[model samples]
Target: SMGNQILGGGGFGTRLMSEVREKRGLSYGVYSGFTPMQARGPFMINLQTRAEMSEGTLKLVQDVLADYLKTGPTEKELDDAKRELSGSFPLSTASNADIVGQLGAIGFYNLPLSHLEDFMQQSQNLTVEQVRAALNKHLSTDKMVIVSAGPTVPQKPLPAPTDKPAEQPLGV
Candidate 1:
């Protein structure tokens, strides 16, 4: 989940946002998520771009994902993800509805009474290698399903991912 956050978990600083939208302007938005349920759940990456840019955008997203899987998140990314998750933890119980939802999920999922705090502590203690290994264990670009809904139009190829040394994600 931490790896997902660093890669594409619906934030302005995520890799997908930084690469696919902010850097190259291929799509207005791009995000990925992992939904862990009591049973099977889905991991999804979604984006929307102009019809003509569909194929190119897909390729770009795939390439970015592939590269991310190969290299994993950087130290800075890991720190940022941890910080973000920790900062948001308190909100999970700030409202009655939120607290009820959390409690319900704990009961429904057969989680421990201290599941929330346990999960938060575990998340905070996770090493970068552990996060990367967990992500790699479950995700593969080749196994992903690509679903697009829009007109099919010819378009120029999108630029490939690059090795720019600056802080910002570039190209793809």
Candidate 2:
């Protein structure tokens, strides 16, 4: 599940996190996500690290995205991402404050009132083909905008993971 992969608005993990943090010690935290809106919201990636690592970190992140675009997510990866989204749906809105927050977003977006009720079912139904098709259709690496802010020090390329054994998550 993503609980181990990437840290986004949620800490569900992905390939980006695996490469940027788990493999290389480029940054302390890194995440990327998309918010589909009436038009197109944003495909944003966020990272935090010491000022000196910024240049290398940014370059590495781009490399990650390029690799992903070259080969979209595998079936297992898609399943894991969807599973995390569906399984955590309830816990995500377990609190009253969370409920209100969700409701506010729904209302502001003019989404159906039944959105939450059907979220899990919809998420679980997503197929790898669908995810891949969507990515191929919407994302183009050549056109992506890169924004970097931090130190300008020359940094070395990150080292590859030595023994990326499957990690055992310790807590929720």
Candidate 3:
């Protein structure tokens, strides 16, 4: 989970956002995450871009993932992610409703009473190699299921602008 968060679950700081959205402007938003389930959950990376740019954008994201797998987060990135997560830890149960929700998840998952605190501490203590190893074990760019939705017709280049009016003023 921390690995996914570092990769793309966080907002602008994530690798996906940094590479696909901020750096290249290829996408308005890009994120990746996984949901826990009784069985193995599905991990997903999602983004939206112009149909004309879809292929390139997907290739770029794939390359980013590949590179990340080869070389995991830096020490600074790990520190930043740990801080962000730790800073937000209190808010996870700031309200009664939040507490109930968290408790429900804990119960449903058969987690210990101290699961939340344990998770926070564990996340803070995780090393870069551990995060990379966990991701490398579970994720593969080659096995991804790529899905695209949009105009199927080939896009045409925009017509060049004309200096003259459609009907010139009374034969100029």
Per-model CA lDDT versus the true structure: 0.82, 0.65, 0.80
Q: Can you write out model 3's per-residue Cα lDDT over 108-139, one digit (the tens) per residue? A: 88899999879888898999999999999999
The Cα error of candidate 3 at residue 101, in Å, is: 1.0
* Candidate 2: residue 34 Cα off by (Å): 3.0
For all candidates, the clash counts are 0, 7, 0
Candidates by TM-score, descending order: 1, 3, 2
- For model 2, residues 1-172, the per-residue Cα lDDT tens digits are 1212322434426676667666665555677777657787777788876565667667777777776666667777767777667677788799999999999989888989999887777767766556556666766777788777765776654455644624412111
TM-score of 2: 0.75
Candidate 3: regions farther than 4 A off: 153-172
Return the TM-score for each candidate structure.
0.88, 0.75, 0.86
Candidate 2 segments exceeding 4 Å error: 1-12, 35-38, 50-53, 164-172
In angstroms, give how far residue 51 of model 3 lies from its true place.
0.7
Q: Which candidate's TM-score is highest? A: 1
Per-residue alpha-carbon lDDT of candidate 1 for residues 24-117, written as tens digits (9 for 90 to 100): 6776678899888888688999887877667878878898899889889899899888899889989989999999999999998999998987
RMSD of every candidate to native, in Å, equals: 3.9, 5.3, 9.1
